[model samples]
Target chain A: MKDTTAHIVEVCPRDGLQNERRVVATEDKIALIHRLIAAGARRIEATGFVHPGRVPQMADAEAVLAGIGPHPGVALIGLVLNRRGVERAVATGALDEVNYVVPLTDSFGKANQGQTTAESLAALPVVRSMAADAGLRTTVTVAVAYGCPYEGDVPVARLREAVRAIADTGPDEVAVADTIGCAVPADVTSRLRAVREVCALPLRTHFHQTRLTALGNVHAAMLEGVTVHDASAGGIGGCPFAPGAGGNAATEDLAWLLHRGGHTTGVDVDAVTRAGRWICDVLGVPPRSAMAHAGPFPTSHPPRGPG
Target chain B: MKDTTAHIVEVCPRDGLQNERRVVATEDKIALIHRLIAAGARRIEATGFVHPGRVPQMADAEAVLAGIGPHPGVALIGLVLNRRGVERAVATGALDEVNYVVPLTDSFGKANQGQTTAESLAALPVVRSMAADAGLRTTVTVAVAYGCPYEGDVPVARLREAVRAIADTGPDEVAVADTIGCAVPADVTSRLRAVREVCALPLRTHFHQTRLTALGNVHAAMLEGVTVHDASAGGIGGCPFAPGAGGNAATEDLAWLLHRGGHTTGVDVDAVTRAGRWICDVLGVPPRSAMAHAGPFPTSHPPRGPG
Candidate 1:
């Protein structure tokens, strides 16, 4: 038997490409989603339904979803910001899950969704009911769960209250997101522990690699019994609202870390790397994943025979 | 009271620069070492005394040492490969410590030092005694302690025997090194445990980030009660003999991880980044450290005011 297993959500096609400067072709996005599934990614955030003017890169969401072939045992998720976005995701008829964001701070909520935090909280149950009626599993992510760009050092009380509010909405899983990559491992440990105290739902962690602490924080979260994580291929993805924030934790790097730490992800490292390199080639950007540049481990070199 | 503390040896000036294609000016090398000291690096590997023809990048060892201004608490170390190299280090009178490598495989030994593993082991005590008589501290690193290029997956018993041999010389510390960055956290845990059983010397870990497991391995070492770690500024340095190996663990990244985990390493993150960026500028390469690219955490941004 494998040591222990965890669920990893490859967010490359949706979260990763949403923030990129170049708009990838619809065919390329579908290809990436397929590759991610082939690499043992059972769940993927395939696309986001936002305004084209807002995120032109994700404007081809419907066409991309149409091109993606359903794979057995894989959940293709589409991100929705409001009721209209939820309708768009449901209309696609391709997504198995619809993910929504619950911005913890009012400033972030107004900036991102043009609604107040209280309003968004009130709307959570409605969105969940709609998605549930559509026969789609729903996930709600608490953005800036650790600290906020608009409000530095979000108090534990505020985060607990937010988790408690989201918990009442009855989402399948609530993601504690570091939207700006500002969290350290200790912060992750304490914050996730706090979330666990108030939340009965399965926990998911979304970390950004802006400060190079994403992997370290992932290790901490694993220690805290967080089995679900969000990562991107080639380390792509950043919050358009969070200034100077870098990419999500690279999928290949996270998979390698998890495997090395005696946890089973069932993700193929080589397949993930190949997908990462391919996407980088598409975007004309360097592959940000360290494993991509460093090549495979136990590099095949013939040992010098008996000397 | 502070949390746990770990000692990190900045090896940029020696191990990092030794592999650079461009030879840094002696003044620049001295400046970089000074910057490291200012960043709370109490122990630094300042230079390597190898044949100038073999490693032209380190040809200015004497000039570089002469240019360094002493910091009160710093221990400047010089790396030497042979007895003659030891003499050269002692003659410089700048290094507080002389570090030697005891290769565990004959293939690596012959390729690196032009000597067999047995010959290097026999010469270890002689070099230590010479450094001891010269009133300099000594450290012997068991290179390829985890895995080797010429011989893949070095047996733990071979490592135990090598450590036992080095232990007999009574060196201050023995670094269990992953010369090719091939180690996983389990490998580090088991191998370090094996080395501890055979050698009572304080253990140090030298890891290359070629496979992106260095920080994870560092966390494992800390759990095993091994506190000393070797890192480089901007993640520079790769073993010339170890093909496909990347740079050493980036010093800034290690310091950030340690600090975030509530461990103290007196090194200032900004100062280390400054040194890292400066060296990268000199080398005409992009800074390899992720933190360097991400900039400092708690990034200052004005909050969107209440509407």
Candidate 2:
């Protein structure tokens, strides 16, 4: 089998927990991170630096980050929207990278960040500058690159234009997000190919399993040479703004698929599944992951020999 | 975009209902079939002709099939495990094809049908002959083609040999089944390619969503030029024998993915989702389909123009 290795960035704490109506305790949040690291997750999006009034679920961002130990080789990341958010993330002293979003459509961009698409793009340089000055790595997530809940299907030309604008900021990586989980394989293939044309930086994908095509979309993008992905444990979290949007692709499912497809994700599916079950238990919701429900492939009892 | 069209065989009625503990009324089953047809499903597995005692959920198969109107261009298929099942299916006068299962593993075969793998293969010729005499189409599904519940991983060479044997019997179509939902893309690719090398007949696939790799595996198989697939509405149906097996790939999800991938499945996703939701209500179970849960892509709420 060919080597199909990729980097996986776990976004459960930030993107996953942010949408929960019930706030996860800071200690539980820290435990989830520990569980993730134990599952071989080297990169994790720890929390969002948004206003607590807007998303109280992530209000314990600073406290949660403070509780985590400085594990070497683990890229603890935080999501930020603007300069002030960047400053708040840097103040946490727990984030190795600061992530930001720039939706391709003005309606979604404005609704999400109180800025138009052009304004969001224009603010990227400042956000990057601040994060860089803080000695933090950076990644810009192009939200709704596949489709906009408000604007409907986005054109490839618009995505190419957005990718060019975001790439110009010289961030370490750029991620195309399916905020509403509306994208299918062809959409992923066409849009990712278009984004790859203008952006030379490493590309990442954030997919929602709302329409049950996230895994397929991930495979489609992987075939187009994309490796880095943002997935949540137990397939938790949906877009709070996008109606009917489901959770992100489960980290364990992604790891299982990637590993079975000859890709080296360096993540243990069983360990992730354990943590996934734990988080879902914490939230009082069923884990929506198929892997979590079905167990691993070739599932068997320990000690293969019969009695 | 390349036209990646595939023939989708909806197995909701037969496969989906068979495992349900609660036996749905015959009228409701007929209603589900009508809804599937309204959604543009031309090929549908109506019910299994297995012994009523063995699968009481399908005990009213004859009544359900008898109630369905024989619409033009629609092929109503029935599942059969033995020669007696072939006889019963032929007597139904409502089926266009008689489908049989010949699991690749003897343990599973014997456990499922009280016959070894070789015995099941030996019975295929007689079943095909009986179905052909009745002017009915024939399909032999090689269950556990991906992996066995008892035997674990099945080798590619074994699949190739089994496909060769099944093809030699000259069934109209041969289906490679992931009975336990254990197959990944590489497994689908390698095994399907191997099966393709031996069988000249049209191919089909039956996948379980156990590990959430079903959609991804379908995409992989589609890329390998294998189109025909077996999917259930609302992602219903789990293997009664395979422990921890998830449901089949949901029909609405498959149609959504295929249509978005530029394939003409000719199925209305919204209509299928409506039926999917209805059937789940009848079963008193939550719809396992993401499409049913998330709604269709480009979800609209009417009035495109601003008031």
Candidate 3:
């Protein structure tokens, strides 16, 4: 299990900068995506197609995507919330995939996308069909799949029902998101187990470092055969709707953890650390990544087996 | 495994404050211990018996222990580095246990205590005997057991050999310390397995959260049947000798992880979080604990499953 390869989906450009008070320059967002790609991130959440008034940080999504241009073997992902978001994302022809969020609880669903859980479920097929018709990939992310800030714990049975509904929509994959970062390793194992029982879609996990269990959750998920995980450079970003939520699991940190655990992430931990530091500098915030500050293991010397 | 009970040995006063640049007042240290006790810490590393000039923060070890006095159910632990430390700790008559440090590498052992790995190993039996004769419990902590900043990776065979030697000394329990915080979950699993092969003694683990893998390592250790773990309040603590080592795993954060995983820790997460915040305030540093800032999982309303 430890020797298997894992895929990291970089979310610094979209989810990482979404809730920042200061909107970053579109060029910088493009630069961050380029850096992430250079650091071996094949799948990147480039931007989001949401209300500009609601999330000003991602207002220049189209321009930012335009600035990134194209790269072979790299998949650009755009986050979509509703019908308008889906339309905006498909109209741009820049993204390889569109990620639609379906909140598990009504409170977060309404707060995040002005829709109820059932409404989001109803919109899934339409969202998937729109991207599918446009020759783009589609992934449905169940938001707050572990626990919700507003509605507390989302039961495993509810999650199973949600995943069953999502599987019916026929998206390319399913993602379970710890939107409020309130999950432990046990939660990851049980919830992923439940989701797997209901759907055969390739599973991805998105965790936040809110309670400092992100890496633990990632490890547990990996043990359960979850190969794809979401992380942000510098551990930046939080949901504006979820109070007290911290940054996402850091890219460099997760890469370091995976690499050290004998899992190949194909990520240059040093390069990702530099990119994390660079993006944090642009945001005028200290990097929330431990690898950014401490560097990779055996910082100064190459590791030598005991003498 | 998730349904078991775990023991947390609070190390905020000794390891937590020992590395701070500013020396905290002895009364404040006692108050911090009292707060931890009130927060349901049964075992506490109250202070270290080392040279005053070397670790100025722990200069008032006797004073701090004297002030803490006696509590029937709580076991006070004093960290000892050598024969002098052991003698000093026993003389104080306040400590119920004396934890001896034995570095896995000569570089760290020399840098930390002016002794080589062999020298520390040679002194362990004597140290253990001195404490045992004084009616004090003995625990041997192998420092840098995972990876060393100065000496890089400490091989598992080397760890097994060291544990074998320490086991011959007949300490009450053996501890593996990731002194530099370079360990991942696999490292914890592998190292603990190696140590268990050599010794039938009870096992404990100490992890630092420098690269944010501490909680994952803790979870891995728990799965390996290690019920005893060390943590510091507010995630305060690092080795002064370790160049880039960060704080120990935060007590409140660890408690939250254990409790959420259905493990009983006999800790009040909210109280420990408050204590963590209070100590950080005293040190004029921000609390490194996630729970200190984000509160617990169900931060607001009581958890209503699926509703």
Candidate 4:
């Protein structure tokens, strides 16, 4: 088997908690971030600086960021919706990166960012400069790069243009976000290939399990030479706009996949699974991750033979 | 853009209905096979001719086979567990090919076929001759090809040896079945590569969506040069003994994927989704396919607005 190196970015703290209508206490967020860093998440999307009035679940974002330890090797990232979001994110010295999302389709863009795709992308340059001045890297994510929930499939030529536009801005990475989980393996391979043709920047994929095909998309991208995969801690993600959209690919499952597929994920599946269990407590619901349901890897008590 | 072709085999009437726990009306089974055949199913596993005492599900196998309408493009196949199963299937005169399963793990074999892996495999040669004498091409399937529920991960060498032994009997096609849906894209790729090293026969894959990774495995295998895939309609299949295992990869979703990924599946995805709705009526659950829930192709629906 050929060796494929893979990286998993933990997004539970952000994507997982972002959609929860119920408010989460700051202490729990702090403890969760600490536990994630301990579980081998080098780059964690710590939180978003969205308006508290809009996302009450994330009302204590600043407090949550202040509470986390600045451990070495664990670079923290924060999601910024626009210039104001970036301004707040830059104020957090703990943040090493600020992620700005630009949608491939104008409708999805407007639905997600409350602006046209062009307007949202136009803000990228400003956010990049602010992030640069703050000594933080910028990553431009092309939301629904593979397919759109409202607009359907985005043409490859258009997506290439999207990647080129973002890559030209000279961000650290250009990612394709499967916001509604509409991507298949071919979409993953071909889209990655298309983006790679225009730019040399590393590609990150954010896949949702809406259609239960995101992990497959991850495998396809990895084959096409992508290394970074974005997953929530317990397969937690959903569009506030798209009601039935499923959760993002679970980090524990993705880590297990990369490790079991002979790729070095440098993640302990058990630790991630534990994180999934803990966060599920915060949500007060059963986790959406299949891996979390299967029990931890190398189950503590060995199978006493099959039932 | 290059045209990458992925082979899809329809398993609706067999894998789809086998676990119904209630015998489907003979006419309904026949209608499904006809529709699946019309949907560009070149190879369809129509039924399993096993003892009615055990699988009372196969009780109407002969009647269903007799009801199949003429379709030149369709190749109807039957799944046979043993020689008696083979004899009953051959008597149907409706099958163009036969698939014989030899599970890799002892527990899965007993649970699936009521015999140990060794005992089941020992009957392969006899079943091989029986099919050959009936002028039917036989495809050998090794269930739990990727990972077994009872056993964690079977060594690749063990898989290779099993395939080689089955190949020695001169089966036309040798397929590895991810019976319990434990296969990832990478595992599918490497294991298929290993099997290719030892056997020069046509390769096929059967996948279940237990962990929702089956379609990714299909895409990875197709990239690794596998054209044929097995899927159940409405995402149905589970071992009587292997509890918690999911159904086969949803045929409708796989067809939707191939069509979206720019492959020729000859099946109308919307029509397949309708069939999924039909099966869900029988199962009293919504179709498990994500695309089924997402609705038909983006193009099929009309004018919401321009993006």
Q: Which stretches of candidate 4 lie over 4 Å from their true place?
A: A242-244, A295-307, B1-5, B38-40, B67-72, B114-118, B296-299, B302-307
Q: List the residue pairs that clash in candidate 3.
A: none
Worst 10 residues of 4 chain B by lDDT: B298-307
Model 4 score (lDDT): 0.80
- Across residues B1-307, which tens digit of lDDT does each residue of candidate 2 receive? 5796788899999888878888898999999999999998999999988888878888888888899987999999999999989888999888899999998888787667777788998888999999999999999999989888888888888889988999999999999999989888778888888988999899899999888878878888888888999999999998676666788999998888888788999888889888888998999999998787666677676213111
Q: Where is model 2 more than 4 Å wrong at Cα?
A: A302-307, B302-307
In model 1, how large is the Cα lDDT of residue A120? 82
My TM-score estimates for the predictions, one after another, are 0.92, 0.96, 0.97, 0.92
DockQ winner: 2
- Per-residue alpha-carbon lDDT of candidate 3 for residues A1-307, written as tens digits (9 for 90 to 100): 4489999999999889998887898888888899999999999999999999889998998999889987999999999998888899988989899999999999888788888889999988888888989999999899999988887877889999999999987889999999989999988988999899989989999999999999989999998999999999899989988877899999999998898889999899889889989988888999999987888887665434223
* Among all candidates shown, the one with the greatest lDDT: 3
Pairwise TM-score winner, candidates 1 and 2 = 2
Estimate, for each residue in A1-307, the C-alpha lDDT of model 4 and write its tens digit.
4787799888888887787766678898888888888788898998988877767777788888888966988889998879999889988687999989888888877666677778887888899999999899999888878777677767999988878888888999988888877788878877888888899998898998877788888888887788899998888768775445688899888887788678998787888878877888887867777677754333344344444
lDDT of 1 at B125: 89
Off-target runs (Cα >4 Å) in candidate 3 are: A301-307, B301-307
lDDT of 1 by residue, B1-307 (tens): 1378899999999888877888888888988998888888999999988888888888888889889966788999999889999999999988899989988888888877787779988998889999999999899988888777777768999999989989999999999988878786667778899988998899999998876777777877887889999999998998776766788889998898788678998889888988998998999888878678866555555545445
Write down the TM-score for model 2: 0.96
**How large a fraction of the reference contact set does each model reproduce?**
0.50, 0.56, 0.57, 0.39
In candidate 2, residue A213 scores what lDDT? Answer: 80
